[model samples]
Target: MSTTPRARVGRPRATAGSTQLAPRDEILDAAAALFVENGFAATTTRAIAERIGIRQASLYYHFAGKDDILVELLERTVRPSVEFAKTLREDPSLASAAALHTLAVRDVETLAAAPHNIGTLYLLPEANRDRFDGFRASRRELRDAYGAFAMDAATDALRATWTLAELGAAIIHLVEIVIPLRRDGEMIDAVRIADACLRLCGLDDAAIAAATGR
Candidate 1:
């Protein structure tokens, strides 16, 4: 709804919920878009409330303030990837590093495309650092899962090569790159970038090809 900019906090997972949360999510989603388009300092909860066709006072019932809405936006956006990556990691039948890389590729593309989500997350203020930590921990579960997968693929070289760390950084950096892309008003094409980054992360040409299904 809104595409501006704002501070980013942790993104948690989206779960099965009722229609009541839907309107709240709509408000947060609009706020995130506005935050990405404008900037956190410039964004107004009133504007978000307006975008949702509601009074500013009504917005308070769904979220406490701007930061709370930002956090909700984050949860709506980022949590699914972590959850999905966990599912992939739990599969014992997974054969190659390519599998993990492949799963990451899909998630990376999704993460990269959601610039409003990314921007809002970064706009989170330091005073909100405690909630930020919780957000990070919630999302980190997926990263930890992927790291394990990456390390396993690297012949248990998690520490020796820091494969998990490297891969995790690579994945997150892909998200970070979206920050500027959105600012520049460029095409937020994630698949193209994800392809190249995955290669650099040691996903072989064949694996990348398979991941892209191209």
Candidate 2:
């Protein structure tokens, strides 16, 4: 009953060989990849089975259906974000803030893009409100940890700064401008974005190359 789907950290557990998939494991992996790509609305169980080189009947040998796949994939992607947030909460020192900022920016970006379809599926109003019901505390903990991180950054910035909410909203607003353009096959002015983000935290770029690789 292994749940990992990939060979990497936090990835779903996968079968050793491609020849014969463990029924349940094969179905979960295929279904996860599909739902993360095409989303729940357009993907089919048949397609999932075919992706794993198995018959449709083989798929049903494990999963209840598509919804089960979608639910599991969502959990797999978001749970790590919650876990990462905990570390930020525990340490709010200057060094901790710098490290958290760098990691959080990269990790959250990866998480957001990992399953392109996951974002939109969960974005449906009311549909995702309770999606993390049992994981509610983790979500709150992540949020509080982020706020604490932001406050530490603001303290460095001086100017008696606005509330962490305002600073965060403002920073995210700037990022929203560049993300869509990058996805549209345009090169992002990553330097400019990183510069602006660092400035908000009262940090100057010795060379954003190190912190952001920009």
Candidate 3:
């Protein structure tokens, strides 16, 4: 006798409704929210799957485990700005002050627009673990880009007082203040922060306006 073929089973529908994202993106988005709200160590793969309304096993199709998800999320927070910094560095027409302003504004926008203020994850104690070393390195690259632009834009007086590392660290610190502002539900002005960076580099009002294209 001929036997009937078994019906093909498909992935289950997400309980979180139609997020309209691919499975991988859906997993990342869900994981970011859970990681930001619940803390990385406290968040389990099962919980991330539940939040997305998928099987815990299904999450594995896109990620090796919770650590993989966390790594990707952390990288997501910095990757765009880092890439933009590279682009700005290569261009010949952009002046250093203007370039710095542009990078700072773009970086601020990147931090502010992250879903659920995901940059706050940087503060997680678990983020210091070895697995996150790659993320730390990427952040340092971004910091160096900031420093280079700041140095190029710096006045003689500013340059005399601070080292390149100090200027870069200070600019990064200024931009990152947006994280706390976002976490507190305060409004952020990306251009304003960019202007602050220009000022920190010792640009006067006219110079800042020119850099800002105002």
Give candidate 3 misplaced runs (Cα > 4 Å).
2-17
lDDT tens per residue, model 2, 1-44? 88877655432333333545465655666675676577666789
By lDDT, the candidates rank as 3, 1, 2
How do the residues 115-150 of candidate 3 rate in per-residue lDDT, one tens digit apiece?
Answer: 778888887787898999999999999988999999
**Which parts of model 2 have CA positions greater than 4 angstroms off?**
1-29, 36-38, 55-62, 91-96, 105-109, 112-117, 125-141, 156-196, 202-214
Model 2: how far residue 151 lies from native, Å: 1.2
What does candidate 1's lDDT look like per residue over 150-203, in tens digits? 555543333466656666665566645766676577776656665655555566
TM-score per candidate: 0.69, 0.57, 0.92
- Scored by TM-score, the top model is 3
- Candidate lDDT (C-alpha), each: 0.63, 0.55, 0.88
Segments in model 1 whose C-alpha atoms lie over 4 Å from true places: 1-22, 112-117, 123-128, 155-159, 185-194, 206-214
Q: Supply the TM-score for candidate 2.
A: 0.57
Q: What is the Å distance of residue 106 in model 2 from its true position?
A: 4.1
Clashes of 1: 28
